[model samples]
Target: MTTGFETDRISRRKAIWREIPAGIWALGFVSLLMDVSSEMIHALLPVYMVTVLGTSALTVGMIEGVAEATASITKMFSGALSDWLGKRKLLAALGYGLAAFTKPIFPLAPSVGWLIAARFIDRIGKGIRGAPRDALVADISPAHLRGASFGLRQSLDTIGAFFGPLLAIALMWLTANQFSAVFWIAVIPGFLSFVLILVAVREPKRPEGLRRIRMPFSRSELGRLGAAYWWVVAVAAVFTLARFSEAFLVLRAQSIGLPLMLVPAVLVIMNIAYAISAYPVGVLSDRIDRVTVLIVGLFLLLAADLLLAFAPGAIGLVLGVVLWGLHMGFTQGLLATLIADAAPAELRGTAFGMFNLVTGLALLIASVTAGALWDATGPQGTFLAGAVFTLLTLIGLLPVQTRLGKREAS
Candidate 1:
């Protein structure tokens, strides 16, 4: 017989599933499949570029940085367009379709320039989909369940992140580490993600007789966005400055004596921690102060950076990677929920766009700097700089947390 505690747990799980809408679930799966496709390429990209294409660490950093920046910059326009058109699904589907088409370019590329072009196109697709898809989740979810909904989507996406590396590892073995061969398998999932979004997700109707909104951020629209939303965007940008691309993590592992075929395992391990912690931490955010949870995440990042900087060997790297993943789990969904909570319903897409744009620029700078530092001072110097940045972020968070706390209580 099931105990009372077990029955209660089951009932709560059922209630949560019932509370989240069908669209949210569908979007979560769409994110899942897309991440699977993207991570498969990403988990191997840095190593492939360095070893096979004869690129330097700085070049890898530059490519990854520029590619991500392209995505972020594109989001500004695509997100504004989604708000203007008042059609989230259409833009999101288009974004995914673009990414799907770009998948073939990775394997077919004969030179570094072609590879860079492919990455740029892929990130543009990501940029187009990112804001509208996030805004769609907010539009579909109830206010009280907002954190959980974002967390659920993040958890599923992270599951894909881990699965991609695992698949890459297997395929690497099967193909005897032919990078392009593994890339070919990624195309299947990319197309599947677009098809799922096209067939399964539906947009909510706008207010009756709404005007065709051509521009999302007129003075009136900006006023409606208020101060809180802008603050969240600032914090997100600072966090991005502290955390550079995960490509560095792969580089660190390779430098520390990991075989090329096993490099993907590093991402697998980090993402496993991310997937495990995301939903639970998201649930925790709903119960406690969101700022407090975010602070904890920041602390975890600091710890991860320090551990990586001073780590002795494989064991220390593993611990640091786990902490890094935990930090991602704790912060990412919480930040998204904060943006959704702060922004007005109609302007959410624009808000997310702005957030990503600033953060993306920050990431480009951070990654390039990290790459330069790594070349000059080695891995320890790179991670130590990250720790310093994380400390700065924590210090900056104090007043913002206090002010937000007072406003929340009031």
Candidate 2:
């Protein structure tokens, strides 16, 4: 016989699960498989480039920055096309397929140029899927469960993020640190992700009354997105600037005397924290004030930046990485939910495209800057710059935070 409290808790869990559409669950697993594929390679790429290929830190940074920017830029077109076609799953599958094909390239790269080309194509696939996939999630989800839905996807994604690194660590040991063998194993999951998406994901039918617009980017259509969506975009771009690429985190772990084989543990630890917290934070956002949650995330990033900047040993390094994960857990899903909340459903693909585009460009700049700073002043300087930018972002958020409070109060 369950106690009253236990029964109530069990019922609530069931209710939340019931609210999320099957498509979302399918999408979550698709993301989980894809992350597993990507992370296995990414967990080790930075070190592979630097130690094996003899690429400089700045060069590594530039590669990562460009790779991410390529993905972001691609989303603008893919997302707009999804809106025009009123079909998301096809484009999403195409993107995943492209990425799946690119997985083999990672193991074959004999030079930095080849590596760059492979990464570029892989990111292109990511760009193609990102906006439409997000918009689709928004489309399928009920309004009340929006936060939980995004959180669920993010949590599943982070599960891959951690698992990828864990596999890399295991393979490293098994192969006596043979990088190419692990890269080869990663290819399996990439194709699996594409198959899962095709079989499992069901896009919501276009609303019967929707005016199918040919020009998703026309000024009038853009105007329909309104001020609220743009505000979220601006703040997210600044946040992107503050955070830069996680490649730096891998490098940071290496800097603190972390062994080459053990470095994936940094991502493993961070993603564990991320996977655990994302759903809970999402549930919290649905219940309380979201801006407050965003602020909390920003502060966590601040702490992470500061900790990474001044940490004296391995313990400090791990702590900083955990804080970084916590910040990601708190804010990433919330931002997606906010975009869904702010945008008109018909224009959601465009809304997400524009949002990702701006932030993606910001990421490009931030990564380059971080790399340049590392070249000039070492790792400390890179993280210190991040701390300053995070502080600025907090100050910038004050007005937004105030308005959120007033709106709720009224």
Candidate 3:
């Protein structure tokens, strides 16, 4: 039933898959395992905090914001260290190890303070690994396959994201809705992730004639990142303002009369859409203008926000979640790819660090604002605010579209 054109297309896709480095695949798997471990706890944490601990939505938002901000700040330093030491894998392994060890604390925490501390420490580990791991992927992948590589890694990570929730849902059913028991089981995968990264990932050798940089964050070194890179960061920070944390998604689902045991299904559904769309979108961006693709992603987010704000019933909620995931798939890897394309190889770690720093801070502001809105005006206001921000981001992208296109052509 396959035509010649279809056969050629299939062969091309196979060739692209084969062209990705083994190390990238290893890194992807590493991400997959860690996300699996993290999401299992996170999918349940918001509801647990609200219901079991008697925390307010505002408190949950504050905790999530602070946790993420801490991670972002840590990334800046850890990323610089990775650049100075020229050993991404060592820092990466150390990060994952720290996270893995911290997993038990989630189940053991007796109070909100202890839970906050655990989440804080866990995010620090995430921060430590994030930039270096991304830089490692950029280093390993050929320039031509950069989009595909990041997409593949993101798809793999999201697969774990969905799987984690599914496992949590299943465990909740089996354990009679015992949250602590599910958290305990989540510890196993975290350790597995740490071990896999330590053993499986092979760092590429540094290129000849590549000078070792002593100060990745020095003024002169930062100047080397250029206007193009900063523009990408600025746009990304603004875009992040529209997205907020996924915790809100869980809250929204619960608000609609979804049972406690099925709450994790919200993440399960969104991540499934995210996992499915990421790779194909990445490939499409590789062949077209990345900025155009990003603009489309913005539109998707806008649509999601509108639907989440005004859509009726369970079907509407599910549709909005899918759109949210699709937007993530279209944009997340592309942003990383943009950073890799813009920054000098020597400064990649620093570039990613700085980029995340700005966006993470933006997310903090957005989450806090969203929580306040949710408390004062309900979920409708929170999501409508998101839609407004999404529109602003779309407008902001106008000036930079030509520049991004020229960069892609170059």
Candidate 4:
């Protein structure tokens, strides 16, 4: 059944896969395990907060926004430290270790305050490790395979994201909907993730002529990142305003009469689509214009927002979730690839840190606004607002799309 062209294509794809560095693969798996641990708790946390703790939708949004913003803020400093020390793995290990230790708190927390503190501490760990880990991937990857590398890591991480929810769903069923019991089981994978990264990931040696920077965030050092890099950050911040936290997706599903036990299925479906599309889209970007791919992603999100806003019944909800996942697959890794392409190697950590900082802050604003809209005009308003933002982002991309292509070609 296989034609010669098909055979050639398959062989080439395998060759590209083999070309990716072992260190990138190790990093991907490390992300996989951590995401598995994190998602298991997160998949249930929103519903638990709303139902068990009597928290409002607005409150949930605030908590999620604060948690992510904290992580992003921390990334800036941790990223700079990694650059200054010229050591990424140690900081990465510390971050993962801190997150691992925080896992028990989720099950043990007796009040909303305690749960908030746990989430806060957990995000700090995520923040500490995020930039350095991303920078490490960029360092290990071949320039030609950069898109594929980030895509592969994202794909692996999303696999864990879906798996975590599936595990939570199963445990909920077996334990008779015992939320604490499921949280307790989630702790094991978090520790495993920490251990895997500590042992398996090896930092590449610094290049012979590379100089260590004492102040990565100083005016002069930041200037080195250039207009092209800053443009990527600006466009990314606009794009982030369209996409809020995944917690809203859970709420949407629950609003439609999905049973509590099956709520995690929302993430399961979205992540499957995300996991399936991410690597292929990444590989596609390697061959085409990345900005074009990103534009396509924006369209997908627009469609998803429209569907989530106006579509009828369970089928509509599932379809919208799938499109949302696909959009994430198309855009997320490519954005990282863009950053890696634009920035000089020496400042990659700082570049990623700044990018995360901007996007993270944007996300906080979006989440809080979405929550307020949910309270005022219902879920429809929240999603329609997302659609409007997505359109604005599409318009914003017009001026930069050609420039992004030119920059990547250079």
Candidate 5:
């Protein structure tokens, strides 16, 4: 049982960042491009649905829910298939390429239905690609620098997130308000990400004995790591339910009178804040207990929910949004790493796949539930709902702490 920390070997090139293992670096570049493309469209999606598309909050929520659900099943199946096939890069490329291929279609959308169609297709691709790509990283990154490896990848991925909205803002200024062009332009990054995965990232051949291993799932053979993994999965599902989506934040900001033109700036601020914090916190989590970092993120969200519920104005909302970004910085990559650490080597894909499936499904429920609460009680109600979940999650952590502590000791 080699622990994650015990595998800390690093090549000189990786230490210098000259060629940080392609498996990990490839994700950074791929995400950089994908985020730039996604944020360009997603940041504006809520506005488009509510204003231009003439949709209700519930409709918007449903669209998001559907997209998330699509991503979940796709991720789970794709991850399982990747492990089954003993191949990774090609599938990941297919997923990214599919997402990229859909980029140009957004500009072609003239109706909410059309946009949802595009979203579904894109999320399908994301779902297909995500878990395998994550498993690939866990497979390649040596144990000791796992934090730095994941952090570097996350920071680079967020670099696109940081730049994507700003680029969209510039396009908006240049076009004097043509969102279609921004969307159309987003296709380029997706294509490039596809290329990178095709050419740069290499998939290790499937593990030996894979042929003898049971296909699909074998619940009977869950293994030594299964108990801790399921506990963490439960926690992640709770976290996902509480986290909801930033689309709500955008909607909330608009409700309080944030000018449409300035919305990009809000996204920029949040992403920049997220980018700055991801790497440092990821590395720190690698050093300490990953769960501790996750708890910090969960707490931040709890506070952000309260802030959203009671805050007075744009400043308060901005602060709340920044807190949300910080929360992501702490948890997102760390969760990926933690699951990898907790899975059997061969079934790591299934572990991440199941984890994503549960969380993604939870996100759909959470998003729709938030919308319903908003309709029933208002944005304040939505915030309060999130707060209640977060508090409950916080309380739930106690028993988990006791178990992990006992495990570590014995």
Candidate 6:
């Protein structure tokens, strides 16, 4: 039933997906499905809230603010609990399972308050699961290959991003903007991800000689390990301030006379760019320092923000979107790897959780701030703000880049 092209396509996928340990590849598959489920609801949430639920922009901002902040706070706790308990996979599974359980509620929600409730539950699940899952990926892979492994996960996740929107668009077309209908269908992929995560992944042993007794300030993650990580977090928050939501991009594209129907195509293009760059960039991070690779990614993002700020038309938007995708490839796994290197294995879950918590919180703030800035000035001002954040991030990371380089040399 398959042609040569189909066979080749299948073979290439098998190899790329295996860049992580086989179990992580499996996790990637789970993420792919979960992302599909998520985007199905999330990509349209703002629009749905505005049009169907009659919510205001500030309400949407508040929902995202509350949800993301909740995720961040929970991530730290979950990660720490995983560290204390010395279990990664079980917590990770529970996290995904909780998110899975919450998916259906969104479609059935009668009011914006209900939607916010469902979103909070889902993001709480996200906060809990993300750190452990990332720690598992780090636990299994060799240090040299960490970047590539996480990259593979990112690549797979991006594939989900591409599919979720297309499916949502088709569902939107068929249902005639029945957003609730799309939400119901999204439940399928969410549960599928939960199931696959349970069935497919296995936890490896804790890293060797991990001290069981909690450390004092000198030995605590909050001390030596915490400083650089916190710096990275602060700088990343700055970058987040610059970036804001991609919805702004979609709105911009549409405002400039790109057909409303074709905006999803632009999203598809960016996801493709992300999928293409993730694996190689990840592999590159393994060979070099994660910071070096991260720098490259951030620079790419800086360029992307600048492009979007002054984008002239469809072509400019396409270019800017692609760059943004490339930036994703750079940062996604790179964040995981950085924590792995800085924190001991026992503390990995906490490290990743903290990283995400900080960045996610930053996003919540940035998105709300961006909206206000847009209301006050314009979209161009919004993106120009992002450019400034990226510049500051680069400066903050310079010392870490030097340290990471030294680690690579050793």
- Model 6's alpha-carbon lDDT is 0.82
Backbone clashes in candidate 5 total 2
**TM-scores, each model vs. reference:** 0.88, 0.88, 0.91, 0.91, 0.85, 0.88
lDDT of 5 by residue, 48-86 (tens): 678876899888877877787889888888887876777
Give the 10-residue window scoring lowest on summed lDDT in candidate 3. Answer: 399-408
- Write the residue-wise lDDT of candidate 1 on 296-358 in tens digits: 999999999999999888998899999999999999999999888787777888888888888
Candidate models: Cα lDDT each: 0.87, 0.89, 0.89, 0.90, 0.80, 0.82
| Model 3 regions more than 4 Å off | 45-63, 107-117, 177-181, 254-263, 406-410
Top model by lDDT, which number? 4
CA error at residue 343 for candidate 3, angstroms: 0.8
Deviating ranges (above 4 Å) for candidate 2: 1-7, 44-63, 106-117, 176-180, 259-261, 375-381, 398-410
Candidate 2 per-residue lDDT over residues 1-410, each given as its tens digit? 88999999889978998888999989999999999999899878998999999999899878877788789889998888988998888989999999999899989988999988888999999999999999999999987888999999999999998888888888999999999999999999999999999998988888899878689999999988876677778888888999998879999998888998688678778888899989889878888878788889999999999999998899999999999999999989998888888778888888889988998889878988998999999899999999888888777776665644554465
**lDDT, candidate 6, residue 137?**
88
Residue pairs whose backbone atoms clash in candidate 1? none
Model 4 scores a C-alpha lDDT of 0.90
Show how many residue pairs clash in every candidate, following the order shown: 0, 0, 0, 0, 2, 2
Which residue pairs come into collision in candidate 3?
A: none
Over 1-410, each residue of candidate 3 has an lDDT whose tens digit, in order, gives 99999999999999999988888888888888888899889979998988998989999978987887889999988888889998899988888998999889988988888888889989999999999999998999998889999999999999998898888888999999999999999999899989998788889999988778898888999998877888889889888989998879989988888888677678778888999999888888788877899999999999999998899878889999999999999999999998998888888999989988999899988988998999999889999999999898888777667666666578
